[model samples]
Target: MQYNANSPAEYIRQVPAERKPAMEKLRERIKKNLPSGFEETMSYGMIGYVVPHSIFPSGYHCDPKLPLPFMSIASQKNFIAVYHMGIYTMPALMDWFVNEYRAHYKAKLDMGKSCMRFKKPGDIPYDLIGDLASKISVQEWIDFYQNSIKR
Candidate 1:
């Protein structure tokens, strides 16, 4: 599940063939729907969408050298995972996603604090994920992070 990739395309290329289409579609949804100012890259070994240093020069508080990670999609050992920092930091966003997910899918939601795991790639909710990606803007995220998450 750990791919030694240098870029998003490289990371997608390393995904298992069976899951490649799902990964590609997932990436496409995020890219198309995410608000302006987010950049696509490889972060934490997955395909990540981030607020680059040009937008927020302070960088991530955990690692000042790294950009502020907003979202990431990864092909894990047993599932495809989507990590969204906004849902983790903002309770309203989390609640909205939870309610919306129930409305969209019959399957039970498999989620963690910040990671949503889909055991079957075909079951992934691409539109719902796209909506989630569009929910936060760069400035909103930066403001929220500064007010609520930074230590």
Candidate 2:
């Protein structure tokens, strides 16, 4: 999606009317469960939580001009997507998350390396998403990100 939004509120306001409720609900859950250091903003054309520049001045290794992104949610043309950077950064976390989802939710874990796409918010396991979000602190993520790129 084209992410021209200057703020998270503006991004939400710009989502299609029919898709608003589901997006809003997922946003709320994400905020409710998000860890302490992450800041919410518009990133990659979606509502994103990131390790702010103040905390991680080097910014994203891929693009140092931008903050280090941790998680994000977006309303797409055909589906809703929740992006978890932790899953891509840490293998054990992904394994634990996928296992928990299969053992408890009983649905096929439909996901890419970091993005989990679903047609509806209810189809997602928010608590599990939250757990992923809460897995690490800003410093920990920065270290992980930096270490990964060195490989």
Candidate 3:
């Protein structure tokens, strides 16, 4: 996946007929939960919901023109992934999420430092996903930015 500016768009455009339903279903789920001012589109070859750069001028890497994305959900060759943003910053939120996931799912969640991946959308635990997405109004993300500066 050589993802560039056109990658996400191309991927969605290239989506096969069989995958459309699941893809659209997941997109709708994310859309309903997305905070205001957050823009939805394909970026870096994935379906990304981004917090526009202007909203947070100093985005992820001090790149004002580049928005800090809240998450990017993708149907990959091997799996599907839901990228959670900067969970490490909110220790309490992270703990609650993991604890709750374990309590309900009875399994250890697998993630690469911050991203969670599953082979299919059906494998996605809706309760846990919705629980995390439901937290904090958009203001909270900005507040996290205001209170915690980039190190």
TM-score of each: 0.97, 0.91, 0.77
The digit string of per-residue lDDT tens for model 1 on 1-151 reads 7999999999999999999999999999999999999999989989999999999999899999999999999999999999999988889999999999999898889999999999999789999999999999999999988887546
Task: Identify the runs in model 1 with alpha carbons over 4 angstroms from their true place.
Answer: 149-151
**Between candidates 1 and 2, the TM-score winner:** 1
Worst ten-residue run, lDDT, model 1?
142-151
* Tens digit per residue, CA lDDT, model 2, 1-151: 7656898888888888877887887888788878788899988888999999999898987899999999999988788899998887688998998888987896567799999888765677877777777778877888888888889
Top lDDT model = 1
Candidate 3 wrongly placed segments (more than 4 Å)? 2-10, 16-19, 106-108
The TM-score obtained by model 1 is 0.97
Report the C-alpha lDDT of model 3 over 5-84, residue by residue, as the tens digit: 45455565565556556666666677787667777776557888777766777766656556776777777666667776
Off by over 4 Å in 2: none
Q: What is the C-alpha lDDT of each candidate?
A: 0.95, 0.84, 0.67
Best by TM-score: 1
